[model samples]
Target: MTPVILTVFALTYLGMILGGLPFLKLDRTGVALLGAIALVATEAVSEQAALAAIHAPTLILLFSFMVVSAQLRLGGFYDWAARRLGALPVRPLVLLGALIAVAASLSAVFSNDIVCLAMAPVLADLCIARRLDPVPFLLALACAANLGSAATLIGNPQNMLIGETLHLSFPGYLAQAALPVVLGLLVTWGLIGLLTWGRWELPAGVPAPSVHSDERGPNTAGHPEPGRPLNRWQSAKGLVVAALLFAAFLFVPWPRDLMALAGAGLLLTSRRLHSRRMLGLVDWELLVLFMGLFIINGALQQTGLPAQAVAGLAAAGVDLQAPAPLFAASFLLSNLVSNVPAVMLLLPLASAHPQGATLLALSSTLAGNLFIVGSIANIIVVQAAERRGIRISWRRHARVGVPVTVATLGIAAVSLWLGVGAP
Candidate 1:
């Protein structure tokens, strides 16, 4: 049973690192699902145990927020925001700053991936229309979303998990994280601006209208075209609900999952937006991925191998309970296995330390900017841009992502050192 559990754990994470098993149609989500299924089928863990392993608060909170994000997307608020921001008559640098501000703020409350998904296409169109290069703006969108999401626990999925599992004070974590996130966003804008100072215009040879698509709407040559116009009533309703939920998370003693679920239920009951449409926008694949990883990770913990491994590492002077090693490990493993899974693997060690939750949230979220695969928000932005014939290659992304990551991580390390004292 030990060997079987170890093998399943190894294979599941290997799938995460490789993005999937070779010669199989399985993606990371599929691989994770299979590992959980194998555990139950072999009776290594009972069905009841497997079911109990899942953390319902995290999943419920995530699902509720997804519903809230879907409401905003369906209401066209994201698209409208992008267009409105881009339409400003400011200089290129001013426009860039505005885009980052809006992207980061929205992502802090809403899911970063969904924000990127809804905004990418509209931003591409805006850039093309303004005759400004779309690449820098797109990179800023992805990078800012990842950075801003670090400000609060609800900003991204991994943060949400850490917050729920550890029961960290939402306001306390925000104070710890606020400086790093804000500084990071500023550094991102500066780097992108420096790299793209004179190169802000679109290449002379590319056709302008090629950037338009039916999903967003048509565009004439070099003219601002509308995509999804603002649904004022629906947008207002979603904003009010989101504002109330944010208040509940901050001050109220109500369970976050219940508060979020209640907010989602209110949004779902809208007569204007169909339930099917709202539900369709939900990322069910991501939910399944979380469930699968929870079971696989839970099963592995039962075998006590993780405990032994940690003891072994500590014996060798590689103490994960200390903040520094945990921070480094979080950053590296986050880029390797992706943030959510990496957080699950490290959460136990982190939860035991004084400021581990802050370390986990900051390191994992910031690491996403290292590469395209490091975060779902990055992938969402890249894919959305690709569909519009605006290519953001790996080399192109790394040019900005690498520096931004280094600078932000440096800020985080210094802040954490001062706040928690050295380990």
Candidate 2:
């Protein structure tokens, strides 16, 4: 029974690493959930143990932020930003810089995926109007979103997981991450600058687009009505909750997860939007994905994986003491399996240093820029570009991805070496 459960667990996570099972219809989420159910049926883990392994604190923090992001999305704030960015009267190069900075900055504070989802179409139309290639701009969106989310603990799912699991200091993590993040943005700008010049060139004296043309023209009958106007009052309420949540991170002497849950609860007391509707907007799929992975991984841990795999690494004189091997391992796994699941798989080994957790957070999150599939933000931008008759081929993305990943990871390594690891 133990071997059967361990094999299923390994296969499930291996499926995660492969992004899905071959010749099968299910995705990573389905694979993980099924793995957990398999453990229960095989009696390797009791229902109680399975439930315990699915840490509720992590789930609450994840769910609350999803609600927060959902509120911002429903409020039309992201849509407004998209249309406005589309209307900028700047050169393609300058526009690319602005797009990257804005996208990354917004992603640091909110959900990167949501930012891309709302901004992609607006950017697409804007590029079409300017006769400048949207491909570079869309790629900038992906790269910048990944770069920006690295700046904050609440910025992305993996960072949040690392924070809860490792008990990392929120402000300190930001300070440690600030330099790589800054250098990353600059490198991001440079890469986008080069790409725009060579691949996205438009003939000189082609006037920059006017704001009107980029606005997609006053509501055409064919286009769907703007997903309701930006709800200022609801938006304000959500913002207040967000501000309080951030304050909780800084000054409040409570678990960050509970504070976030409180803020989410505050938003739920509205008379207009149905609570169910608001909850429905939360990415329950992601939460389920996390829970399933946790149970699957927990079962693997019970199988003496450390003695089998980690001890062998030690036997080969490979040290996991500092961030060197761990960093390299995480960098590869993030690209191989995606960051969130990678973090879940590795967090068990990083429970030593107060900064170890933050290291796992930063390395996994930033390593995402290494390739197109390294992060969802990248895919979102590419898909959005495709929809607009633009194409951001993998080769085009790699030109930017390689340098950004190398530079950011270098900074992260040195930071860890010098004991500046998120203390």
Candidate 3:
């Protein structure tokens, strides 16, 4: 049974690294789900244990926010926001700054992946319309979304996991994360601006990419119609609910998951937006992925191999309990297998350190800017641009990603070392 669980876990994570199995249609989500099923079927983990392994609070909170983000999309807020930013009558560099600001702010409240998914295509269209190259702005959108999501526990799935699992206070984590996240966003803006100087316009003899309305993909329920008026009322409703939720998380002593669930309930009661429509936009696959990974990780933990491995590393002078080793591990593993899985593997060690949650959340997220595969936000932005006939090769992404990651990680390391946000 140990070997079975180990084999299943190893294969599942390998799928995560490769993005799928060889010659199979199973993606990371599919692979995770399959691994959990195998464990249960082989009696390595009982059905009850598998069910118990899923973190209900994290799933509830994640699902609730998806509904909230859905409401905003349905209200045309994202489209309106993108258009407003693109239409700003300022120098291209200044416009890039505005984009970084907006993307970061929205991502801090909404999930980073949701912000990118909702905004990227619209941004690509607007940039083509304005005859400005969309590459830098798209990169900024991805980088800012990743950086900004680190500012709060609820900003992204991995941060939410870290906060909830470690029982870190919302405001406490915010205090620790705000400085590096803010500084990282600014650094991202400066790097992009410097790299794109004098090359902000579309290349000579290259026609603007065509925009097809239907290419927005399956999650298009709330996408804005070209001539449709912004639904200010619906947008306001979503915003108010989000604001109240944020306040509750900050001030109220109630469970954050319940408060968020209540917020989702409020948004679901909208008269104009059908419940089906709102629910349709929720990332059910992500929820399933979380559940699957939780079960797989839980089964692995039961074998005690991870504990032995950590102890072995500690014996070798590579102590993950220390800030420096943990920070380095988080950054490396995040890029290797992506952030969520990396965080899952490292979370058990978080309790050993004073600022483990903050360190994990910040380092894993900031490391995502190192490559396109490093974060879902980056992938969303790139795929969106590709659909519009704009190609952003890995080399092009590396030009910005490599420097932004190095600078932001440096800031985070220094801040953590100086006890800037230490509790």
Candidate 4:
């Protein structure tokens, strides 16, 4: 019974790596849920133990941050940034650098997917207005976001998972991730610049609406809502709350999730903006996805498989404490199961080695540059591209992705070696 239960568990997760089970209509989440049911049905784990394995702190932390991000979004924060960026007057290269920088910075704080989701169409429209091929610019958006989000624990779901599970210091993780993230963004821009060099033909004319599809009905800048015309009072309130939150992250001696949640709550107590409106902007699907993956990963842990896998790798001359296998494994596994799941799988093993968690976070994130499907930010750009009649196929994406991955990973490996400590 143990063998059969374990076999089913392995097969199910392997299917997760492929994004689905063979001959089964199941996505990664569905595959995970199925595995859990099988484990329960076969009595491999008791109901109580199964529940215990699933980490609730991580889930609560994830959901709370989503609320904070949601508050900003409903306030038209991202759309405002997009329009501001789009409205800028600068040379193409300057504009490109700014776009990458903005994407990275915003993604480093909020969910990268939401950052791209709100920004991609606006950027697409920006490209059309400039008569540039939307392909490379949108592609840059995805890669930049993935790279940027890797910079902070709050940036992407995976980083949060790694931080919570490993109990990494919020500021400490940032120290490990900051350099690679900054460098990665630069490399992303360079790669995009070269790839789109000849590709930028000015669109027919300087005319078209903005590309922000899911934005609020009226552009806050364009149409004043009778009285809510970008009040300094409200904006100041939000900024004050956010700034204090950042300071807390660096200096406050508390769990990051709780601090962030309190900040969100502070922002929620608005004089004008209703809580319901803010709540609507939250990415519930993503929060749900995190919860589901947590339970599923918990089930896998119950089987004692990760321990054995770690042992096997250790005995086989795989010193994860060393940079080589650690780097390679982080990169490969990130692409294998997507970065979030990959982080969950590896966070446990990361405990066995020095600086393991830091390397895991950096490598998993840089690995996102390997493929279009490698990160949620990538898909946002891809979907937005499809809407604009521009397609960035696997090959087209790989042209930049392959080189970007190699170059950035090389830089990350060296950086990790230096500041991440000795083996």
TM-score of each: 0.96, 0.90, 0.96, 0.88
Q: Candidate 4 has what TM-score?
A: 0.88
Q: Residue 106 of model 1: what lDDT?
A: 97
At residue 274, give the lDDT of candidate 4. Answer: 88
Residue range with the least summed lDDT across 10 consecutive positions in model 3 = 219-228
Ranking by lDDT: 3, 1, 2, 4
In candidate 3, list every pair of residues with a backbone clash: none
- RMSD of candidate 3 to the truth, in angstroms, is 3.0
- How much lDDT does each candidate structure score? 0.90, 0.77, 0.91, 0.74
Which structure is stronger by TM-score: 2 or 3? 3
Poorly placed runs, candidate 2 (over 4 Å): 198-228, 419-422
Q: How many steric clashes between backbone atoms does each model show?
A: 0, 0, 0, 3
Estimate, for each residue in 129-154, the C-alpha lDDT of model 1 and write its tens digit.
89988889999999999999999989
> Cα lDDT for residue 170, model 4?
76
Best by lDDT: 3
Question: What TM-score would candidate 3 get against the native?
Answer: 0.96
